[model samples]
Target: MSDRIDKSLTRKKLDKTLKPHWVWAIALGSSIGWASFVMPATWMGEAGPLGVILGLTLGALLMIVISISYGVLIRNYPVSGGEFAYAFLGLSRLHAYISGWFLTLGYICIVALNATAFSLMLKFIFPNFIEQVKVYEIAGWEVYLTEILLATILIGIFTVLNIRGTTISGRMQFIFVAILIVGVLTITIGMTSSAETSFSNLTPLFTPEISALAAILTIVAIAPFAYVGFDNVPQAAEEFKFSSKKALTLIVLAILFAAAIYSLMILATGVAAPWQEISQANHAWGTGFVVQEVLGTGGLIVLATALTMGIFTGLNGFLISSSRVLFAMSRGKVLPKAFSNLHSRYNTPYFALIFAAVIAIIAPWFGREVLGWVVDMSSVGVSIAFFYTTYTAYKLLKWSEQDEGYNPELHIVSPGKKVVTLLGMIASVSFLVLLLYPESPAALGMESIVALLVWIAIGAIFYMIRRKELAKYTREELAYLILGKDQFKLKKEEE
Candidate 1:
């Protein structure tokens, strides 16, 4: 083995202040957003309570397997950019850019997705106030000036809070997550304790029209989108005060906790009233409708409060995550270096935060359905990142085993880790198949497919433009910037 020094490049680092609990809060909070509260109708309609619960449980298991791959990568290379950095180290620069591009799509679009949900929640609580001043319509969904203003204001607030610093944002995330948990428990307990509820209301475990496997697969296919937050941990790895090994436990715990909350919300919906009726009733907010039925207007107020917090947490978490991804990519010279600029006093990625917020603020103008198409497309991007990380782990493990000169001191690969990485890759491919396969129940709509194509085209154009700028640097110089000075010494032969 040979090691060489690359002295020309200097790495920029984020502030390290995230505690273990705060990291957990970030992952859990980001995963459980307005979708849990506002949109159970589609899943509940396709799969009854039992099917949904089973599906989510299985999904969590798959995520845990994938988490093992993430943990292995983090243990070996604890850096910012998560999958982007991993792909570059274990795969190639081209793979890294692809991973970063898709990961950016997933993280940044979610910021807009959550912000748009805020306007929808306002419309639910104060229809007269929020629905006024109709601006325009896209795909039959009305765009209101009030809604746009509300979303923009939210995006702006979170952008400023994140730019202030991660310490401030992490603490705020912890508190908001606590409130969210309390509110969720309150709603679930109230709905379950109501005299009108009967567990039998969840009967016919699967939707009669669909096969049981399909019912469960429908939810399983969206697991990448649903369980995205845990990966955010890797994005902030450079700033982790604690050891990266500890993050694996936090990730698994967060995934389990999120899964429990999701199942409880679905259970609350089913038991409060006949799930079939709630599904068929087709209320804009099915969960909200049931809450009002069980606990009256007071319950609606509590649920709305919880949902608002969810939206807030989602906005804050994704802003932190997306900005960090941008900063990492910029540091690697894959994106414009301007994105890596930091705030003078606070030391946050101000340019990236502002850029992410600006993109999100513009989303509400196009209306909710248009945003939905983007989100649907973004899920594919999320799954792509997952696959890249898992595949990277698989490559590293196999390389370690096959290389006669492999250094055990460098990385100790436990006997069964190779198997786990293989399983993780299989699970990731399954998620992709479910989303992209036309015959699959969870396949993307035509609009979402078009959105996916557009995003890929945009990435291709940007990559071509960036490659010319990057031609000035040798491969070693590029590795020093992306993997840092210490890691660049350990770089493998270029593929």
Candidate 2:
């Protein structure tokens, strides 16, 4: 083979430093951030305790099915940018750009959400220590200069850590996640063992105002945000030291584990006191207040510790994922080429990391309440990416069977596999409708809708600005840049 052919086959850029456990930690950490800690009461308020369990379980099952499509694509392509690379190869460059843009929005929003959540956690623990120096107010929530500074400092620390390399960040993720799990388990045990707790406290299981089905769908609608981290597995496929076949198992496990943690937190919150009372209380952090109410100072301390770890893991994991997506898009010429450049010693996407961090740092200035609006909007973005990925897998499988010249090494050749991807597509679409449809229980408010529209408009304008430059590259050249010339050649050989 010529040197050109040799260069095409190898992925010598990003270091393969992620172990199986680190990947799992990243997925679980990303999925179980501030929402799991602070929003249990909100979920209880929306659907009641039983509704929270039902919705999260159903949502997780749906995600597991969707992950099957991700598994298929990762095994076949195993590139960074996850769905971005899949859509580019199985669909078109336009589809790829759409997927990358929305997914990037979702990941970056989560990163900012976690950073802002850090201040909220501190407020609950110290009660105005970090809430000093009020800067402004938006949407009934005050934006404190101290909070912004604290959040910015956290974002800056993670940015430098991530720019150094993945191995360091990955190891830290594993440790933080382990401590977080212990903290959650401690809370669960304490709540269950307490004399003040009772299963009867979970009465009026579903909210009377909404139908039970609607209540369940409410949680299911935001499942994309709740279970966002598992897809990070695909985003880091290029950095996997293990077999791509393992990606599916890791993704599924992460989703299931995250679901359990969410359920436990809700359960602990419910049994600690009359969940209805807690739901109705004027507490800023309902779960925190309830835990502290029943278990006192000891309980509050444990819960605070867990919340801190959850925020850290979220920041670390999402930074890694968001940067990788940008890097992959840049390498494929979907974005500016500077983002594709890796650090000399770290072998990491330095420019992309810095860019994501800057966006996250700016988010706190908008006030913590406004970040929630962006997060709700970002759920729609993630759903769009999920649809594209599942649809691409379905399309690839159909082509393989119908075209005499096409055959890739699919692990499971069962006729039923296509049905899974089809179901995934349907599920993905349902989540989107539940979020975007006004009649749906989980529909976004006007503010969130405006945010989503603004993001879409910005993405469209940015793509048009880069379209002419991207148009200059042939499909083959783009494929070589994204999939590695060797991998692209191998794909051609299979076809």
Best by TM-score: 1
For all candidates in order, the CA lDDT equals 0.85, 0.86
- Which stretches of candidate 2 lie above 4 Å from their native place? 1-12, 398-405, 408-412, 485-495
Off by over 4 Å in 1: 1-6, 398-405, 409-411, 487-495
Worst 10 residues of 2 by lDDT: 486-495
**lDDT (10s digit) by residue, model 2, range 1-495:** 233332443333688889999999998998888789999988999998999899999999999999999988888788889889887876678888999998888888888889888888888778659878888888888988988888889999999999998889999999999999999999999998999889999988998889899889898888998999889999999999899999998888889889999999999999977788888886889989888988999989999989999999998999999999999999888988789889998889999999999998888888777888988888888898899889878866652355554555433354566799999999999999998889888889999999988988998999899899888765666777777643343243121
Lowest summed lDDT across 10 adjacent residues in model 1 is found at: 1-10
Q: What is the TM-score of each candidate against the true structure?
A: 0.96, 0.94
Error of 1 at 244 (Å): 1.3
The all-Cα superposition gives candidate 2 an RMSD in Å to the true structure of 2.9
Q: For residues 1-495, could you state the per-residue lDDT of candidate 1 as single tens digits?
A: 114434656678788989989999999999888778886766888887888889888999999999998998887677788989887876778888999998887788889889888888877777899888888778999888988888888899999989889898999999998998999999989888889888888888889989899999998988888878889889888888889889899999999989988988898888877788999997878888888888999999989988988888888989999998899899888899889998899999899999988888887788889888988888888887888988878766743555754555444556588789889989988999999999999999999999999999999999999998766665566666776644353445454
What are the candidates' C-alpha RMSDs? 2.0, 2.9
TM-score of 2: 0.94
